[model samples]
Target: MNTNSNLNYTQTGDYLLPNLTLNQPRKPLGKYGRLRRTYLKEQRPVLYHTMLLNGSLYPHLMEVEQTAENRMQQTMAQLLKQNPVPDKEQNQMAWVQHMNSLKAQAEELVLNELIYS
Candidate 1:
């Protein structure tokens, strides 16, 4: 029983796999992730401030934002469905204004219902 024969080897190339093992716990996010999280928290303090106040709320904030986004998307979809836009160059300006109004209202609603509350 040649046990060595069972093992396969390959020539080393320009790329080499890092000596990482599945048993070893993976490292946390890098600087960029941290920075992005910080930025997002700052942008929506009402929602994300809880993370700073209570570290455990970090995951909760993510869930809150996800739910808020889903609600906004649903509302926007329903509005557009109910009020179909005319696909003409003359109606382009009106379409844009309508979209902007919907977006602003959605933002306010999200902030009030999800974030501030």
Candidate 2:
């Protein structure tokens, strides 16, 4: 049996099979992470496979999720600053609607820039 770096091999018959395992902790993925995973698996299989083989998929997904969530917050704050909504005390429904619109727009921006791309 031959070994190099972090890989271990088992010999069976005439071939050596390398053992593969993920060293990342079992952390729960956020919504954006799942979305990015689905997009990569379906639309970008080659890149997905490469990342998986190299053991960087989960870390990349986590980074994307965190970045997307932060971007969403920043974008929502900027949008709210530019387009102020009516006070919640004066018009609760209007405030809710405007906030929902901002959230949707921010999500779209994250999806376009991070998940799908």
Candidate 3:
């Protein structure tokens, strides 16, 4: 009986898989990103290029959205505290409508601020 009868050999490269990380921040530009960035820099040197290079544009928008959400939650909590809804089943529709209105107003305020700023 051969001692190496159960021994097997395979190519390691055949089973290789790419290591991917979920939390990795992607490059802002993908295909043709460099060209687009260059074009923006050349055409709109002061406003677009400066904001893009400083990384201020997206962060500012994110901050605005967060502010709007926070304000909406605070306003909704205050309104609910002031006007307690005793009957959940009876006022369910009205409560939803009121909350939606408040949310729309908050969003509008954020948009106006962004537009005028």
lDDT by residue for model 3 (11-117), tens? 45765333322322243433223433454467656865466555664454444545655765776676667766446578888877776776666556644553334
- TM-score of each candidate structure, all chains considered together: 0.50, 0.86, 0.44
| Per-residue lDDT over 44-101 for candidate 1, one digit per residue giving the tens place of the 0 to 100 score | 6665555555454445545665677787898788777887766658888887888888
Top lDDT prediction, candidate number? 2
Ranking by TM-score: 2, 1, 3
lDDT of each: 0.60, 0.91, 0.52
Residue 71, candidate 3: Cα error in Å is 2.2
lDDT: which is higher, 1 or 3?
Answer: 1
Candidate 3's C-alpha runs over 4 A off are: 1-46, 82-86, 114-116
Clashing pairs in 3: none
For model 3, what is the C-alpha lDDT against the true structure?
A: 0.52
Q: What is the C-alpha RMSD of each candidate to the true structure, in Å?
A: 12.2, 2.2, 15.0
Checking candidate 1 for backbone clashes, the offending pairs are: none
